[model samples]
Target chain A: MHVIESGNVAAANGVKLARAHVVAAYPITPQTPLTEKLSEFVDAGEMDAEYIPVESEHSALSVCIAASSAGSRPFTATSANGLLYMSEQLHWAAGARLPIVMCVVNRGIGAPWTVWNDQQDAFSQRDAGWVQLFACDHQQIIDTVIQAYAIAETVSIPVMVCYDGYILSHTYMPFEIPDSDTVDGFLPAFSPEYALNPAKPCNLNTVTLPDIRPDVRGDTAPGYMEIRHNLHTDMREALNVIKTVDEKFYSIFGRGGHCFIEPYNCEDAEYIAVCIGSLSYQLRDVVDALRQDRIKIGVCGLRVYRPFPDEAIRETFKSAKGIIVLEKALSYGYEGALYADIKAALYDCDNRPFIHNYILGLGGREIKTQQLLDALRQSCTIDIPVPQWIGLKM
Target chain B: MREDIIQIRWHGRGGQGAITAAKIVASAAFSSGFAGVVMTPTFGTERRGAPVLTSLKISKHKINDLSPITEPDMVVVFDHLLLKEVDVTNGLKEGGIIMINSPRPAADYSYKGMNVFTSDINSVASSVGLPPGIINTGVIGLFAKATGLLDLEPLLQAINIEFEGRNPEKNIEAARLAYENTMIGESR
Candidate 1:
């Protein structure tokens, strides 16, 4: 059924369709509405899920971890500081290789404090071993959440379905809600190979020694090295899983075959602008304007941010004359995190495009279309230079 | 006449339901005929009565521009007091419109080159027996009548959805009352 609602509401509906076993989250701006909708669904008996109202983001994810470990398909969401508070648990969730799905409503992290939109929150957590997928619109917000669950369970890695906080979360738009029966057909029940067997009583994630260790049965158990190695191996394998799940979703629902990257007019473009989350959608209008101005430019919104989709990125931009890497998160003394990754991704290309990076929209700064136009126009005309800041007062 | 995307900027205090009003219009426009409607509340400080703004963009096709609407087709002022504090029509397009909520008639307020419409929404709120704090719904009626951008039935329907349990009839009545009272003023 199609309805006009907030992106948060769309995400909540996605969770409802996914049939999350446990819903735990703390209230935060932009993300608050999403949490409230889940609680409403639970309270009204619409969704048969354990609605755990946690005290903090840490407890929220902790509840999800416990639920996921207990063989439940658990879910949680937060933004900025809340996500930061769950930093340790993030590693625990990923390192343990639990199939937990989280919605990281992207927001600016606080030093001075902001409740607005940015990709910094999720971008800063890039190395946490979670499969991060970004959404550009309300449709993608719901679709990605459902797809996240499928991807997470397939490979047993936590998934963060990231969308810009206020930009997508609070805005109201039209999106079709996939029917429950078809959704069930698309995603099977949570049948994990490993779970906390309460009756058998074995501690999961016990302290592993540096080298190979043995259990009470005198069998060689995977030590710390093998554990990390397995996780690393599975994460790389998840790229294909991401593709298969997206195909399954499309087969059932008839939309969203764009799994790794969503490309717009990039098939034969000279300059391709790249970014994550909703900024990439906003850049589309700018690309349209540039097309009118007789410039062959397109936009590539990198949906899967980790396991880093390097091969896909390389193939998409190899034939382009220039590549503009526009991002919201800066590595603080270096360039944009995505800029560095895309730059590294191009090294394997036989004829690499001249890549440029523009760091913009940190802490909810406005990135107007005109600014995007000028930036891409410069990247198309001017030589590659150091990372520049868009809309900088100085 | 610009017929592609009708972008409207809403100006009101933080707690006065400016964003809520924008969302209602977006909902109404979507159900009425338009294929795309997006309501974005400018995210920032939300202390009550502090100036807050939001924008509603409705298009015949999908809207890809998520940037704040700098060049709006119309500006809806939920509080006339905001007019004195800020230039409510800063980047309004040529031949754009303005709708204001005040006790004064439509002629009392005017902006250069823009058709101004004003209605006594506070009085409409009282006469319609709306809550003391519920003036935003009344302003929607004025917005609908002045702009003719949306139909009355869907506007009231959207209000019914927004105020579903909290006396939706009162809001519907307020919208109807203000819609009857609104009129376009001469633009100089």
Candidate 2:
């Protein structure tokens, strides 16, 4: 159905269409509406799911872990502090290889206490063993959530679909929603290889000793090291699953999107801007305006951040004269997380561009167009400064 | 108005439906075949009677800018009292349009440097039996009639969808009353 809605509502629709059996969440500012709508769906008998209104974010994911382990499709959502609170369980969920899907409405972390948009909360958890997909708009939010379930269930991994808080969450846009039947045809029911059952009792997360032990089949069981190694290997394999699911979704829905990075008008451009999440929309405007003046500027939006689309980044920036990476989250005492990844991607490239990283719009600060324009113009010079802080009060 | 993009900023109190008005207008524009339509209500803590802001950008082509509308082609004030508390004309384009929900004549509320249009949205809402504090569609009708940015039919359609179950007829009636009763004026 074609309807005008907010990103939060679209996310709820995605969860409903997926027919998830368990939704466990603790309401945060921007994440509140998504869960509220889900609760409404459950109450209205539109979806047959148990909406667990947990008291804390930790319990939210904990409940999801229990539900997912019991051979049920589970979903949850949180942002900023709530995400941080659930960090311990995040590792547990990933380690257990649960195909749990979460929506992390990206918001500024509290120290100064802000409830607005930023990517730091999710970026800070880049090593949490969950696949992270940042959405550009409401439509992408809905589409990515559906794709996330497919990718997660197939790869035995968790997926977090993120979009900037309030910016995409509160803002209204027209999104084409897929019917439940279409979605069901695209995403099948979750059937796990290993689920906790009383009939065939199995110990999960058993303590591992220094040496490998023999299994009942006379084969050596995976140790703690091997388990970690397998997790890494599965993550690497997940990159392929992500792309294949996106292709299948496009074939069915006719709206194809880049699984990793989306490059806009970068084929014949000298200067390119790199950003993530909803901020990419603003950079596209700057690119278009500069293009009108024949500045040959382009933008590349990082869609998937966890697997870190290294090859795509290298390919997109191979011929560029300069690259400006604008990120909302920083690595404290270093540069932006995205900049670090980009630098690593092009470290061995033959034609590496003069890269500059600018951390902007932290803690919900406004990133104006004029500031970005000036930064881009300054980046064109020969002697460019790295890690230029845009719109700093100091 | 710029043919490529039309930016509008709305000034109103927290409970006056300024945000809803902006959304309805954008929905109307989108329903009228404008593929690029965005409506953003200012984020953060909001309380009733407190001043708030929202913005809308409508384009025939794709709109890439996610930034707030710093410079607006049209400025809409949901409550006349907001003009006293906030600079309702801030960043308004030269010869741009400023609309207010005032009962006075358009000429009476005209500012020094922009065209002004006035409509008694409150009266229209009251007459149509809409409860107090819901004048979004009424002012939207006045906007559609004054600027012709969106067609009246689409505006009504949007209103119908916005207030689908809660007496949509009253809201549509309020909108029609505002559309016919609105007074438009030239630049002062």
Candidate 3:
């Protein structure tokens, strides 16, 4: 069904359709509406989910961890400082291999308390084992939520569907919401391999020991090598499962494109710009206009961030003369996180295009289409600059 | 044939339904067989009474321009205060139209090189027993009178579609008052 709704409402509907059993979230700017809408759905009997209004972001994730361990499809959402507050639990969730799905309304962390669009929150958690997917538009926002459930449950890893804070969260758009039955047919019911059951009484979250060292802490425990290997393998296997679930999703929804990466007008383009979140929409128009003028320009939107699609990245930029990386987050000392990843992925490929990193739209600064076009033009002309900031006043 | 689309930029505060008004206008235009897109560059920290700019592009052809309009063929100011805070007149094409929801007459405001139409949309709304914030619908009616780009019948039909099954009568009455009270002509 087509509904004119806000991104938050769309996400809430997606979570409901995905049949999440438990949703625990603390109210934060931008992220509040999502939980609030879910609460309404719960109260109206529209969704059969337990709406847990937690005390804080930390407690929110803690409750989600507990719920997921109890064999329920658990979901939660937070942003900026909220994500920071739940940082410890994030590691716990990932290490425990809990199939928790979260909607992160990306916002800037604050000393000044800015509640605007930025990737600082999600990007800061890049090392966490959760599979991260950034959505470019409202439709993607809804679709990714459903896809996240399948991907996370398939690999027993948490997944985050990240979108710009105010850009997509608060903005209203026309979105297609699949009926509940249709969603159920697409995304099966959650059935975990292992869960916390008192009857079985299995050990969970035990201490680990160092390799080749005895009595390191006090007692011998699980090997650290084994734990690390397990986590790595779970994450690695998640990449292929994400692709498989996305293929199934495409078949059900009848929308065909790479769910992990959306390539726009890139088949024969000379210059390509890579971006995620709302900026991709702006880049799409710029590429279209440039293509009309016979300027071989294209765009690639990286939807999947965690377990980054390295092979796809290399192939996407293989033919381009130059690639511009548009990021909404900064790493301070080094280049943008995505830029570093792309550079590392293409290090072995011959004739690799100069990858210019453009940091933009931080603290919710507006990024116009002209600015994106200007950045693309600059990338085509000069050597890809290091740590270039776009739309910055100084 | 090139579609003669009328792009409008709406300036209002949050909770004022500025975005909803744009959607209703677009939906109305769509119901009239014209293609349109409604969008807003929302902020994560948007609050009540905060300045928000929403836009609507109505044309017979597909609109692929996602960029915010630097210059608009029509400007609709839902709040009087936004006029001072935002440059609603910037990039306003020649012979463009400006619709302001103010009780004061059009002659009171001085804006050269553009046609300004003024209406007491709030009073009209209150008279119809609707809230003051429904001035966006009034502004849309003024848009219809100023440009004739949309017919009132389709506009009302679109409004019914939006408010239908929920407050349909009041919305239709609000649209009618707005269509009647709008003062349309060239700016002084």
Worst ten in a row by lDDT for model 1 chain A: A198-207
DockQ by candidate, in order? 0.58, 0.58, 0.34
**TM-score, predicted candidate 1 vs. hidden true structure:** 0.97
TM-scores, chain A, per candidate:
0.98, 0.98, 0.96
Write candidate 3's Cα lDDT for A104-163 as tens digits.
999999978888888999999999878899887778888889989988888888999998
Pairs with backbone N, CA or C atoms under 3 Å apart (clashes), candidate 1: none
| Model 2 agreement with the true structure over A1-394: per-residue lDDT tens digits | 7777889999999999999999999999889999999999999999999998899999999999999999899999999999999999999999989999999999999898999888899998999999999999999999999999999999889999999998899988889999888999999998888788999987888788766799767999988888888999999899889889999999999986688888888889998999998888778777877878789988888899987778878888999998899999999988888898898999989988889999998877888888988888788765666788999998
TM-score for candidate 3 = 0.91
Write one digit per residue (lDDT tens) for candidate 3, span B1-188: 11355678888888888887888777766667664354555443568988888766667754444445676898888877788888888888887888888888777777887888878888878887876566667766776776677788887877787777967677777777777877765565
Residue B106 in model 1: shift from native, Å?
Answer: 1.0
Task: Flag regions of model 3 displaced more than 4 Å.
Answer: A211-222, B1-6, B13-15, B29-36, B41-52, B57-68, B79-87, B103-110, B131-134, B161-166
Report how far off residue A159 is in candidate 3 (Å): 0.3
Q: How far is candidate 3 from the true structure (C-alpha RMSD, Å)?
A: 3.5
DockQ of 1: 0.58
